[model samples]
Target: MSLIRSLRLDPLPVVTTARVELRPPIASDYEQWATLRGESRDFLTPWEPTWPGDDLTRNAFRHRLRRYAREAREDIGYTLFLFGRADGALLGGVTLSGVRRGVTQSCALGYWMGQRHAGRGLMTEAVRGIAVHVFETMRLHRMEAACLPSNEASKAVLRKAGFSEEGLARQYLRINGQWRDHLLFAMLASDPRPRA
Candidate 1:
């Protein structure tokens, strides 16, 4: 193969819902991303993993982009930032990680919404849009997600996106510096999607 073709990464297309657009983060998004994450720190920290000391630094964002590019090149993960379609405002981000092929054909879904943008149902729309990209475009067989049992908003988003609750996982993940139990949810390619 030519050098360019050999270095090509898997396509990560922009996905659009009614009010949100999902696309991979670019270098220009650094300022907006940093601002949003910084502002939402208090609101998001309770449900997210403890932030690294330099989490919002430009260097850290560069590292994130590098990691994302590497993951895409390896066909192991995809990360997209959600923006308001009409005003082009950064709303949040979604990640489809830990992808497995072969008989599995599955990956994990993770997301976060800016504090200012929460409670608007934008996340549900973004999740649903990404689901279509996952099942139809990426051709993955299944998508999985988990959230702390106490997170009613996250649970509602998953349900609205047509994911069925599977079961609870003990100490499934570390959030806010503590191991927390999480409720697992999954959706298969054959599953019916909610109307948009």
Candidate 2:
């Protein structure tokens, strides 16, 4: 008989930093997540795929939660919402997606922050925390990230978090309604971390 594998993580993992906590988004988080995304629309839209007309609706959030749960159960991805450690304020979100195990143990990293939280080094902290989890807990070999070449803030965040620029991807993804080119970056499990 062939051995079977159980691919579920009960009570999804939560990663935390000195100032923030990152956990999967739950139904209780809907209002905060929606409010922050709504307020940051103009600040975020340029770097993101165009939002669905009902993106902030409760029904949409329910759909998102279901997908996140399914991906987690399949060991394919983890999407986490960041919150202030002290006040528990909603900060933003980060995701480790497109996970590939076996020969290519790697995943893609992506994140977004509220406009008000920008320029505070919070995203850098979140990225570092997630990188640790990806490397140590998940034992993944590599993590990749991509951003519009013009998004200098994102590039800086990736750099500070120990990811090295890899190259450019032509029209890698559709952002704000158009296919856009992106600068790619990657961090390997064997790479040295930038000292704090």
Candidate 3:
């Protein structure tokens, strides 16, 4: 790779399928982010945090950007944007958070998408791309994910990304408000990659 190409995550991998573009979120993406997320309020509330339904202000968006920047520097994990490649319309967000390096190089994968974008194979493709980026660019050893037992869609995504169904834990995570059971899935460096 050229020095500039090596220095930047440019050529951003576009990660396009027939309908989606999985790439890094930019400084100007907050507007669409708010729209898609806000619209999915009811659909996502059951699985995610209960934020104010219509409270995505510019200030909050700036705060999110600041956190993203800090996380990038600290190598916490990456939060990518999902969009329609042809028109560049925002769809949702995908994250690989809590990254740890050294002997136990591993990170946890997490993601959320708007209701309209759900059920398509876009997320599966996005997850595959994130796994590739994690193992190749970040040089991580393992990637793990937690999903509600009832979330078949999420389980499918992990399986497509080459994560094995490890086990189940009671009250594995606090979802929305109460503790919820989560199934654990993981992918090791030795695992084979999966196609979109």
Candidate 4:
């Protein structure tokens, strides 16, 4: 028999915070997601990678769901959509990718907030809630995030979520078709949780 055991999150996950709920995206979310992304295109494009021509289409969403499912099945990543708890509005998304096991026991974090929800502190709450699931439930050691030096709002969110700025990376990622430098940050499981 093989020694490897499955790490599949069979039922997926739904994480709740004070103001938001984080859950996996579903087929029914395509309309809301596409509308929100379409409206926020200008506001988000500067900080995000270039989008494909058909990125907002239902077919693209189906492909995205397929990829997410494969990642979850292989225990490589988790992607959750953030929604307003009271109104059930889709506000943004968070992804924990590049999940490393064995000696590393870590993952990379990425998030995006809709234009309407920017500066609301909801993303911070979602990040903290996901951190709890990552460290306590998934038993991971560290979560790392990197953002452009000019993204002050993102930096603030990470800081409020208890991540400590580590250093700078040269051309860490491609944003808006350009390779950009990024400020790195990390939060350890052993670190004390930030109080609200």
For residues 87-185, write the lDDT of model 3, one tens digit per residue.
Answer: 888878788789897888999989988899888777887788777777887788999999998988889888977899999999988888889999999
RMSD of each: 2.0, 2.0, 4.2, 1.7
What are the Cα lDDT values of the candidates? 0.95, 0.93, 0.79, 0.93
What is the lDDT for 109 in model 2?
98
Best of the two (3, 4) by TM-score = 4
**All candidates in order of lDDT, best leading:** 1, 2, 4, 3
- TM-score per prediction, in order, is 0.95, 0.96, 0.87, 0.96
Instruction: Give me candidate 2's TM-score against the actual structure.
Output: 0.96
lDDT of 4 by residue, 1-196 (tens): 1223263335677899989999999999999999999999999999999999999999999999999987877778989999999999999999999999899999999999999999889999999999999998889999999999999999999999999999999999999999999999999999998975
Candidate 1 TM-score over all chains jointly: 0.95
lDDT of 3 at 176: 87
> Which stretch of 10 consecutive residues in model 3 shows the poorest summed lDDT?
5-14
For residues 84-181, could you state the per-residue lDDT of candidate 1 as single tens digits?
A: 99999999999999989899999999999999999999999999999999999888999999999999999999999999999999999999999999
Task: List candidate 1 stretches off by more than 4 Å.
Answer: 1-9
Backbone collision count in every prediction? 0, 0, 0, 0
Query: Over all chains combined, what TM-score does candidate 3 have?
Result: 0.87
Q: Which residue segments of model 4 deviate by more than 4 Å?
A: 1-10
Superposed model 3: Cα runs more than 4 Å off: 1-19, 52-55
Ten-residue region with minimum lDDT total, candidate 2: 1-10
Model 1 pairs in collision: none
